[model samples]
Target chain A: MGRIRLTLCVDDSHADDLGDIAGAARRAGMTVEQELSGIGVLTGSIDADNLDALRAIAGVTSVEQERDVTLPPPGSPVQ
Target chain B: MARKSRKRPAKKQAALETLSVSPPEQPQAGGSAPATAPGTTGRFLVLFDRSAAPQAPNTLRRVANLSLASAADFEDGIVEPEGLGGADAVMLPDLAIAIASAPPEQTHALGVASDTGILAIEPERVVYTSGQGWPLNTGPAASADDMAPLDYLRGYRDAVNEVYDRLTGQHDAEAELGAEAVTAFDEADATWGLQATRVVSSQHSGRGIRVAVLDTGVDSGHPDFAGRAVTGASFVQGESVQDGHGHGTHCIGTACGPERPGILPRYGVAHEADIFAGKVLSNRGSGTDGGILAGIQWGVSNKCAIISMSLGAPVQVGQSFSQVYEHAARRALMQGSLIIAAAGNDSRRPARVAPVSHPANCPSVMAVAAIDERFAVARFSNGGLNPQGGQVDIAGPGVDVRSSWPRPTLYNTISGTSMATPHVAGIAALYAQADSTFRGRVLMSMLTQYARRLRAPARDVGAGLVQAL
Candidate 1:
């Protein structure tokens, strides 16, 4: 099992960076999917070549693994 | 005006039944003299057993110009001071109040007061008379139209205006959420919690986000929804696309109700967006995947920027079709539609119950859990610690929240991730509206980053609880 990072876009200029990230991921032997611009949902294998490539890309403001999504604990009733 | 024993019944019984948590601290000087300062006449008359008073903090407190009376101070959340004892004999009587519906205990008291014809209820609402029929006696309720005396015109004006002021300060709740929903402090944000209904009036009110309320139909005639363009269709036969169950109304209300407290710049989200209501279930709240599928198709085709699904289908355990659902969610994402789904209410199990529901279990969509102000997951919100790690995207306010309902009225509150789902959808809309270039990755990323996570952290909480920008 492997982990993929997610990034998002705030403007159109971020579009090209999306392609770059996907290309880097492709080179690294991993899958890169674009939900939109800086926000790309990554999954599958981590390609060695793409690892250093995408991280170096500009405008990649933030990155987090998909599985780390925060969830609330159970039964917080607010009456 | 002796206590007319023959005029009505329950007066004496009701008076004797009046109980207080504790004796008024002042013990004297009652008469609307303020709860803290106390007047000679209105000292509390404890009717219940002396030890029966609740030991919580006393209701006696003198704030800056007014003494606040906690709603909790009353037995039924209402205080009827004059009726606590013989209307004439009660000392320093300030105001006597009772619900217009007259709960059994209150009914007896009013019935007795009616003997002296002292009971004067407003035409359609509650009216508190001083002792008997004298409306102007308390000075707060006396209508200006009643010509009693000229010398006290200012007092009468102040009293009636007090009532009138309350009625006039309607706050112009833009989305027709009514007076109950005053623009309040968004305790979550630590600022005024922007009115939920005000989401309707804005430049990009969900224009990019296509929200599908997958529940009962919605009230098209709602004032917040009035004049706004929306497409209507129903899976329920003969159910003319109106909010019958009221669930959808609330979900949609929170996502994007209407706008107020703005132009002056108040806190609100998602001003540009259009809603596509998916009436998958019948008005009675039951439906199969067929209607749901149709609703989803509608959302997909209409190019909704975001689709909010608050309902769930009970799928059996061990049965899995994760691939197919994931594929559809993937397709929705590719189509530029951000799908925000409720994590589902299955608090009984910490693990995602199976056979998991469709749509929500889909990988491409963002699954949301419900949380309270303290950032705890709601009892009903489904939890997950993903085989991958955190499964939920982020949490939103799913607690007791007021939102839209089907008419004769427009807004109220109900709890469920169903209520929570649209809140995320609205924020997504806000993101998309603010920046059209915002696609799935950017949108979800922003949401996850800004979300306030809970103790369950990676397990019960998803990306974390969502915090407003």
Candidate 2:
């Protein structure tokens, strides 16, 4: 299965324990990238087949595919 | 004064009650009624001094023998007209105003009761709109009635012109010179966006407030921002906070450049605001959700009052917003930080309109649309096309916007919803500085509430163009 980068939102109840949620996510077949404790979010990569496993982790409210943003070239008139 | 009862007959009371409950009656077109004088309902509007509002009911009873149904007596202060049975007046305690139908003598008595706190008494008038004028008789027209339609058309045209004049401050003698009134903004001394948003006349300078611009980065070495306190951090990996791409510098320039620049025409908004430049995107103008979220976390941790993001990836139609972003936005608001983002510039206009881009599509994040100097929605500016969590919050001047750019190119003029996002961010800083209490969700609401209403649809302009304090 292909690996997909994702952003996981921690539940409010587990917001103070982002470290524990990150640990849980790691055990559920995810490569932890960043732990954004201020906003209770974790970014990582996981196998497509193991998506349900990551979602099923305790304190993980949502697991969304990361979206990329690109602006127009500097020389472009409309930015 | 002695209280004397002047009870109305039961039949007359019922008629008055019906009149109060029913919509205002439309006068016949070209009727005998004088055109200059406004049509009045039999009821009078009574104004009371604020300090005297609480005693209004008792005062009215003592002075004019008029009993009042106080709005405060009802739940949530919602006074139902039909529920105001047998009362001579309905008193709105909060507004210190009253609507009443009383005899001329009683009204005179209330007006003269200075000790009782009555301010003024005036008759309520019948209001009409340009779209729905006094009902015109569409039946067979007589030859003499041909002039009537012409007259009505002239009146409608004048009403529209008058409203436009008031909105754009075109009533001044200088603006009476034809074309200038239509395009009221002149960038002789300041950028057209600043003039259009009333930033030129604003007194607040965003002093003591921290504004975070999460984009590529900012040019700290720029001459315009020489002595300004700018704190910067890079969330993008393998890149320094120094803005290699011009996008971040331009945004920072618009939001917190300088009071007096080396070049002519002021472009920045909050000159005194401390700048927190968070580089979330790479020098190539690209970034992932993780970098953006990290930037947000950094801004929130620093207690930045305003976080402006002029970058977003366009979402497809019927696509729901990211729950992760929405939750983060809510958390930011809870901590007294407002997240503002561009509503995207993927639309072609007059052909196809696109939905607001994400993270902006998140409900908690304010989605700012772009308008031109003429206050028309930009062709590239996205609209709130989706039903779920994709509403445009407000608008700002974006087209032909002049602001700071990287060195060797000190200034640049561009057009996009990207340019508009900083206008809002800058103005929000001014508002935050004006009153320290205005932060997070309250600041967001105030921005919309105080925006100048435009003739455009709410989907295109939201609450209209964002204005300064």
lDDT of 1 by residue, A1-79 (tens): 3444433222235535656655655665556543332122333335443555545556443332232111122122321
Report lDDT (CA) for all predictions. 0.50, 0.84
Q: Residue B276: error of model 2 in Å? A: 0.7
Predicted candidate 2 versus true structure: per-residue lDDT over B166-202, tens digit per residue: 8987754322211122466667689988888899999
Q: Over the stretch B285-316, how does candidate 1's per-residue lDDT look in tens digits?
A: 66654355456556776777777787664434
Model 2 interface root-mean-square deviation: 0.6
i-RMS for every candidate: 12.2, 0.6
What TM-score, over all chains together, does every model reach?
A: 0.47, 0.74
Residue B142's lDDT in candidate 2 = 22
Worst 10 residues of 2 chain B by lDDT: B173-182
Residue B403, candidate 1: C-alpha displacement in angstroms: 0.2
Residue B40 alpha-carbon offset, candidate 1, angstroms:
69
